[model samples]
Target chain A: MNRLRFAPIPAGLPATVPFTGPETLERRRGAPFRARLGANENGFGPSPKAVEAMARASADVWKYGDPDSHDLREALAAHHVISPANIMLGEGIDGLLGLLVRLVMAPGETVVTSEGAYPTFNYHVAGFDGRLHKVPYRDDAEDLEALIAAGHETGARLIYFANPDNPMGSWLTGERIEAALSHLPDGALLILDEAYAEFAPEAAIPRIDPEDDRVIRFRTFSKAYGMAGARIGYAIGPAELIAGFDRIRNHFGINRTAQIGALAALQDQEWLERTRLKVGKTRDRIAAIAASNGLRALPSATNFVAVDCGQGGDFARRVLAQLAAQGIFARMPGVPPMDRCIRISCGPDHELDAFAEALPVALAGARED
Target chain B: MNRLRFAPIPAGLPATVPFTGPETLERRRGAPFRARLGANENGFGPSPKAVEAMARASADVWKYGDPDSHDLREALAAHHVISPANIMLGEGIDGLLGLLVRLVMAPGETVVTSEGAYPTFNYHVAGFDGRLHKVPYRDDAEDLEALIAAGHETGARLIYFANPDNPMGSWLTGERIEAALSHLPDGALLILDEAYAEFAPEAAIPRIDPEDDRVIRFRTFSKAYGMAGARIGYAIGPAELIAGFDRIRNHFGINRTAQIGALAALQDQEWLERTRLKVGKTRDRIAAIAASNGLRALPSATNFVAVDCGQGGDFARRVLAQLAAQGIFARMPGVPPMDRCIRISCGPDHELDAFAEALPVALAGARED
Candidate 1:
């Protein structure tokens, strides 16, 4: 019984879990959902001055946080004008994409992304054994010139991409991600993510050159600073790739009440423009509840929407198993023609009136199976 | 300017930080230190029901936390009677020692540890290029048979130790770490680090076999459950090495108000036995203010003490720079005769009366240099 060995890339990995938490499907449906609207979080919360600075930093949680998250990286380098050595803060954006795939991918290198993007950055490029490369999603976003020609045909030292996209809440604009930075690939690096850069459309946020060592970006007090369970996030690059994430991070891996609740949710950018007008009117009431259940919704800039579900992916997995048999958690897109779409998220209108009363009885129980 | 490359073990490491925190020396001493007692944190706080469950989970910080921190790992597996599949939790114990040195360190493997004990586990075994070794401190504790004879003379593969030790808060008897696990090294493993297992000494806690795949332990809601800025911790072991930390943790890196303030600071074990009788009366008032400044103190079971300062390590680095020129933040020990001591920590008598009124003016300004 002498097992305990492991390190051949986590013994050829496989424990996986890049997203499942709806409290493990309400502890396997012992109740509790009635529409949480799957993980793209920001359930319309966070900046009541970042929940009063995380209840005044929870009685100073016995102190250790400032592992140089120095006043939240000097208030995120004066709110992104940059240069707190181009900010780093972590433990989110899925721990800064597993420290930017352990500081630039090395094990069997190459990375790219897109095909059903952000499976936690392909579970941190297969927990660092790297060599990923997908790049499909062309019409429904994230296909920046086929991920810069699959990072110039796989010389890929990391690419990723995201920008207002996630399970089909497509986008692009910031001058087409600054004109796909002259088709990247000469020493790769891109990443970008922008975890729904505050529900997009500030011209979809491009203006790069934070010392552009090709791109890094990230961003995320978990979507529109609603503080996704306050894990914190940040990246913005090039101060030598954000000081090469202090040569391997976890320096007090964040969380002092999520660095004073993400510095009172970045000094309340007026509660992030009132959570971007409540996620643009809950993304137009989830596209008028997917056009009263006939479905179609898709054109989102973020805060989650998707919809489609007219057919395929086995009728959107039987309309997400009849919206989890009416309790409703909702999620979709795991490849295949974008899993005929479902997604959801933009919460709070009584959880979008319990997802508009569980979407026409989950589309007539997925059209009577 | 092409430089964003890295990954050859973070480009041969170096941008280090294995502890420099006291808010970067109070922002390079522009003040603010009247005794924070360096990084052995827990200034005796935390469970007012985990600061009322982190101010009632700060308005449910928009979901995301339960990335399966499933009710604080089923209340730390019923407070360690074990088997929540032998637990894991993380983002602290310096991020589960950088995901247990990236799931058992491969590149040039090796490991061991002790010399300067926890420099964040030798900055994650030199950020995963591993090959560490160290093995020194014997009388000041942690030598565990020269770290199991340097893990059977460098066949190493992770060793680490730490029981009630750190710097020089010496300890040993959990039946001398369960009789030094029959001199380990079979497949190696060990790790241990019971982050001051609640100010140690329940016979220095050592009844192993939680399916001992040789060992694992860890612990910490940041020491004596005070919650070190709520980074959380955990570990335990065996269930297939605690499910090889989901093959590479950061599963939404826990922090829903630190998993509801560490499950209300682990169901308040009477405020962790009243923070171990206020860190055993502030470790006997820091060994009676290091014997009224003549200086000696050492023998501690955690919550910090050290002291020593009779000589060398340049008179304990001139009495830790005259206790940081009077603001008194205090900390020492980095190899050598445990750097002729200095440490301190156990606080709350008005921060140890500002470290007993700046220790005889920092030992008369380090005996006039």
Candidate 2:
């Protein structure tokens, strides 16, 4: 039998996933997690309007979604006060990141990011056979200076920076990001992932020009709008760069129900604000729970809080495992310093109560270990 | 502003989409299509069970879909009497095709396909900088022998062939495809797009070994399953090849509602059989309508009927425009010889009635042109 010939890049890569889903873990553990807090999904749920829209659209799934995503794009453009041409909707931030990497980073070209930034972004870079230059996080936040330096040193084509950082839930002021933009390497494009933008303080939201060629900002319904399963996100960039996505993107890839749901979600700012309040309260509840358990919760602007176990990475791992064994699903950062914390997403009160109940037992188990 | 540096492949490509969706056309025309038939979507709709499942799943869209798509894959595997490892689900066939091209076709590598075959597949090839070797259709059907011959000549890495061919609604017997398998070029893999397979005659549905290394069969919920808007599809191939998708695919790309909806759709085979019966009736109704309008409807093993306008490509195009002007959405083949016909999808009786009402007027208008 002839060997199945794969392109050199994929063939050389390992068959690995960025993250193992909680569902897979549940199957393995032979029980479901009582409190689903892993993956940073917005457990406050999508807008009631969005859910209604999706449900209503369910029967209409016979028709293909508009390949142009015209209405949704128009609404998003209006919401962002940008031209429709400046926005490109995709399956998710993950899908759009893949396209962005493919468009700019040729094989062996370099990209720079903090060591423990988004693994999915790293996965896309590897998938495209792009070399990654990593910089360590500074004070548990993505170090913009270090990243820019690495980009300059490596002559990288792209630099990825996520604000309201995952795993640690640390953030920088928008002014800081705006100031750092001018320091970007000459040829490198900055990929600003604002997946948690809705949860951040207004001061943390950058005010970059939509036509800015140096950066492309990605936002998702998955995090704040609570539509992760809908698989929809959009990137705001220069018109030309946005148009470039059409050259390679799957034109009709967006799900019809998702498009409708997202559009409705965008229109319901009241629901979004309500969700923010719920998330804010949940964040506090989580922090209080951590305090009770003798662990410190890092200040968080996003829906998830990274609670410092006050121990090293190994201790945090043990705590996370114990939490899982106690029917609580949570994740910790993979790299050092950040891995001293286990990330927990804000959910409804009952789920938080479950987490509150589970943390002490988990910490005790980890201490015993 | 430094010009955005795109990788060589995309930089050289035109910003063109595979198809201008019906919605885009409606926007341009300042009117909605009375009958949405142009995209070959299932107008009969998904199973009620599937619709209910999707609607119920809407509230849970706050969580990311199981990246593994375990339950759906398991059901599909059981239904096909194959191992789950043989199946890989994607956003849609379009998304999977893009991944497949990226996985195998290196820059400037050759791929073979029928000239006017699924344009999305060709779009992906061009996106990846793969050279496409086109073979002309034989009697309005994809020339399998010629495609294999071109593959051999070009030492192509992939050959894309669709069963129950689109645009012309032509198909070859499964036995013929089984015979052609042995004739594939040494290194080329066959991309057997069975998107229309459920609507095809039983004899046209190929029964190739699931472990056949040379062929990967793509099936979609978009067509007969009535879930085009849901964006779910699957590919059946050798286990190793199926596993290769994990190396690059967006793990959480599938919509949560779509996964649940598709699983339910798969379970409701009775609904699918009923849809097939309805499509058969609709095909005959379209043919009868064509006959009344003094046109010939080609024999179709799929949901849509290709009605020869008894004119050339230009005249057929004019007729299509006239139908569109009358708020009827229909499409014709893009290439010559086959372009003498306009394709109409199987829709509800009222939609077919709208088409029947518009056809004679369209024919007269085209004659005047």
Which candidate achieves the best TM-score against the true structure?
Answer: 2
Once superposed on the true structure, which residue ranges of model 2 sit more than 4 Å away at CA?
A1-3, B1-3
Report the TM-score measured on chain A for model 1: 0.36
Model 1, span A1-369: residue lDDT tens: 254777898888788677788888888989989778888888888888878878877988888888778888887898777789888888887888888888877889888887888787788788889888787887777788888887887788878888888888887888988988877878887888888877877888889978878888888888888788888888888887888888888888787877887887788898789888988999898998788767878889888888888777888888888888788888899878888888988988987897788788877887887
**Model 2 over residues A1-369: C-alpha lDDT tens digits?**
364778888888889899999999999999999999988888889999999999999999999998899999999999999899999999999999999999988899999999988999999999999998999999999999889989889999999999888878889999999999999988999999999999999999999998999999999999989999999999999998999999989889999999999999999999999999999989998989999888889999899999999989999999999999999999989999899999999988888988988889889899999
On a 0 to 1 DockQ scale, where is model 1? 0.29
What TM-score does each of the candidates earn? 0.35, 0.99
Docking class of predicted structure 1: acceptable
User: Where does the lowest 10-residue lDDT sum fall in candidate 2 chain B?
Assistant: B1-10
- Complex DockQ per candidate: 0.29, 0.80
Candidate 1, pairs of clashing residues: none
For candidate 2, the per-residue lDDT at A182 reads 91
lDDT, residue B230, candidate 1? 83
**Residue pairs that clash (backbone atoms under 3 angstroms), model 2:** none
Residue A64 lDDT, candidate 1, scale 0-100: 81
Interface RMSD, all candidates in order, equals: 17.2, 1.3
